[model samples]
Each structure stands twice: as C-alpha cells, then as structure tokens.
Target: MRPLPLSDEDHQMLLKHGKELSDHERRITDLNNKMTDTLKSVDESNKYLREQNNHILEAIIKGNEKNDTHKQEMEVINRQNLWKVVTIAIGSSSVIYLILQQLIHVIH
Candidate 1:
C-alpha cells in the first residue's frame, strides 16, 4: 500500500522497525571490525611464535653437531689413554723382573 493509505500507527511501527534494523546493522559492523582486528593480532602472534620456534630448532641442530664432534674427540682420547696405561704396566713388570734376577744372583 502507498504511504498515503497507511495509518499513523502503522507508519510509526514501520519507522521503529527500520530504526531497530539500522541499530542491528551498526552493531554487526562494529563486531566485524573488532573480529578483523583480533584476527590481525592473532596472525602477528603466530608469525612471531613461528620465528622463535625456527630459531630454537636451529640452535638444537648446532648443539647436536657439537655433541657429535665431542664424542669423536673423546673416542680418540680414550684410545690414546688405553695405550699409555698398557705401556706403563709392561715397563713396570720388566723392571721388577730385572731387580729380582740380580738379587737371586748375589744370593747364590
């Protein structure tokens, strides 16, 4: 029906409904803006976290490489020490045998 045919009550009711819808649209727009801002903040946080994790992973890799190098060096040192110990034990035994032999010769 034309606006001219509508009663005052119906016009007022329609105006109130339109105002309510306008208010709802404004609220929806505000909520959308806030959600966009929140999403941007979240994205920034995610990016920062990813960078930190990458740095940590790099450090771990470097540490593992150092550990491997140290292990190899320790193996070489251990082999050298084993040989030194064996040589000392053999030399001491030989000296002891020679001293005992001289003592037996003098006694006889």
Candidate 2:
C-alpha cells in the first residue's frame, strides 16, 4: 500500500468541497422540514374540508326532507280543494235542474 501525500492546494480543495457538502446537507435538512410542515398543513386542510363537506351533505338531506314534507302537504291541500270544487259543482247543477223543472211545470 502506498501512502498518498496531499499538497496544500489539494487540502484547500478538499476543505472547499467539504464546506459545500455541509451547506448542501443543511439546505436538504431545511427543505425536508419545510416539506413536513407543508404535508401537515395539507392534511389539516383536507380534514377541515371533509368536515365541511359532511356538514353540507347533512344540510342537503335535511332540506330534501323538508321539501318532501312540504310537497306532501301541498298534495293533501290540492286534493281537498278538488273535492270541494266537485261537491260545489254537483250541488249547483242539482239546484239549477230543480229551478228549470219548476219553471217548465208552471209554463205547462
């Protein structure tokens, strides 16, 4: 095995390289921390969005139920109104026929 002797310039070059590697490592660590923070923020935001979506879905369901109830009530009212109209028409027709019969008998 041969022992290698490093010259002054070579030592200086190695020092420069070492410093650059150290700086790069620090930068990598900083970037990793920033990425971790970003991921945490993203996760929190996703959770919040999920909660909001659930709330909105619940509101929609409740609104739909309310609308169904309203529709049913309206249908009941419409049926009652229809029956009232039919009854009134039948009564009015019977009264008019009686009046005409009486008038015809008097004429005869």
Candidate 3:
C-alpha cells in the first residue's frame, strides 16, 4: 500500500511532539546527572565516616591496653605492700620475744 501524504497540520503536530520529547529527554538527563552527583557525595561521606570509625577503634584499643598495664602495676604494688606488712609483723614479734626472755632471766 502507498504511504499517505502528511497534511501541514499533521507536520506541525509532529514537530511539537518532537520538541516535547526532546524537552523530556533533557529533564531526564539533568535528573540523572544530579543523582550521580548525590551518590558521589554520599560515597565520600561514607568513606570519611569509615576512616573516623577506624581511628576511634584504634584509640579505644590503645586505651584498653593502657588500662591493662595500669592494672598489672597495681597488682604488683599490692603484692609488695602485703609482703611489707608480713615482714613488719614478724620483726615486731621477734623483738618482743627477745625482751621477754631477757626480763625473765633477770627476775630469776
């Protein structure tokens, strides 16, 4: 079948629709570009947050290590204090015993 010739009004309508379609395409492309920019910004923000989180974790680990060292030192100090108390008690007993023996000898 032979193609029908398009009227002038039909040609005008085709041109208008084409222009609208082109406008729609432009809008769509602009929206796609903005979305891409937004996604990149979000990715950058996430990367920075991850780095900060890692830094915080490292600091916490270091703080824990320091606390453990302090605990060990405290334990050592406590052991030393215990030994000092025992030694003082033993030395006092020895002196008292010696004095009592001397006094009994003199009385006898």
Candidate 4:
C-alpha cells in the first residue's frame, strides 16, 4: 500500500498527540511503581504479624503443658491421701474386733 503523505497541519497535530501519549505513559509508570511499593509494605507487615502469632501460640502451648503437669501432681497427692485414710480405717476396725473378743471372754 502506498503511504499517504501528511500535510503540515496534520504533522503538527501528530506531534501534539505524541507528546500527550508520552506524558500519559510516564504517569502510568509512576503509578505502577507506587502500587508495587505499597504491596511490599503490606507484605512486610503480614510477615511480622505471622511471627507474632507463632510466638503467642508457643506460649499458649507451654502454659498448657505446665497446667497438665500440675494436674497430674494433684492426682498423685489425692491418691496418697486416699490410701492413708483406708489404712487408718482398717487398723481401727481390727483393734475394735480384738477388744470385743476379750470383753466377751471375761463375761463368760
């Protein structure tokens, strides 16, 4: 296809349009850079929050472990007290039985 020749006025209008397009491109590039920087800032904040959350989770786990250990110790103490009470009751019953047997023999 043969190229159409532009008139002088048409050439001037084309130059103005080119300048406007170049300005628009520069603005778009600047906006893209700002958006990338904002994204990076948000990513950094998210990483910090995730680390804090992990720390909190670890602390909670430690506290739970301590509570479990304390509960186990309490159970052992309760068992020991129960055994002591049972032994005392058995000894008292045996002593009473022997005293009753002696009293019956004397009466006879």
TM per candidate comes to: 0.86, 0.83, 0.84, 0.74
Q: Which pairs clash in model 4?
A: none
Tens digit of per-residue lDDT, candidate 2, span 1-108: 996999999999999999999999999999999999999999999999999999999999999999999999999999999999999999999999999999999999
Q: Please list the residue runs of candidate 3 whose C-alpha ends up more than 4 Å from where it truly belongs after superposition.
A: 1-3, 100-108
In candidate 1, position 103 carries an lDDT of 98
Q: Model 2, residue 103: what's the lDDT? A: 100
lDDT of each: 0.98, 1.00, 0.99, 0.99
For model 1 the TM-score comes to 0.86
Order of candidate numbers by TM-score, starting with the best = 1, 3, 2, 4
Q: Which lDDT tens digits does candidate 1 get at residues 29-91?
A: 999999999999999999999999999999999999999999999999999999999999999
Shift of residue 81 alpha carbon in model 3, Å: 1.4
Query: Residue 27 in candidate 1 has what lDDT?
Result: 100
Model 4 regions lying over 4 Å from their true place: 1-5, 92-108
Query: Which residues of candidate 2, in runs, are more than 4 Å off?
Result: 1-3, 103-108
Ranked by lDDT, the better of candidates 2 and 4 is: 2
The per-residue C-alpha lDDT of model 3 at residue 91 equals: 99
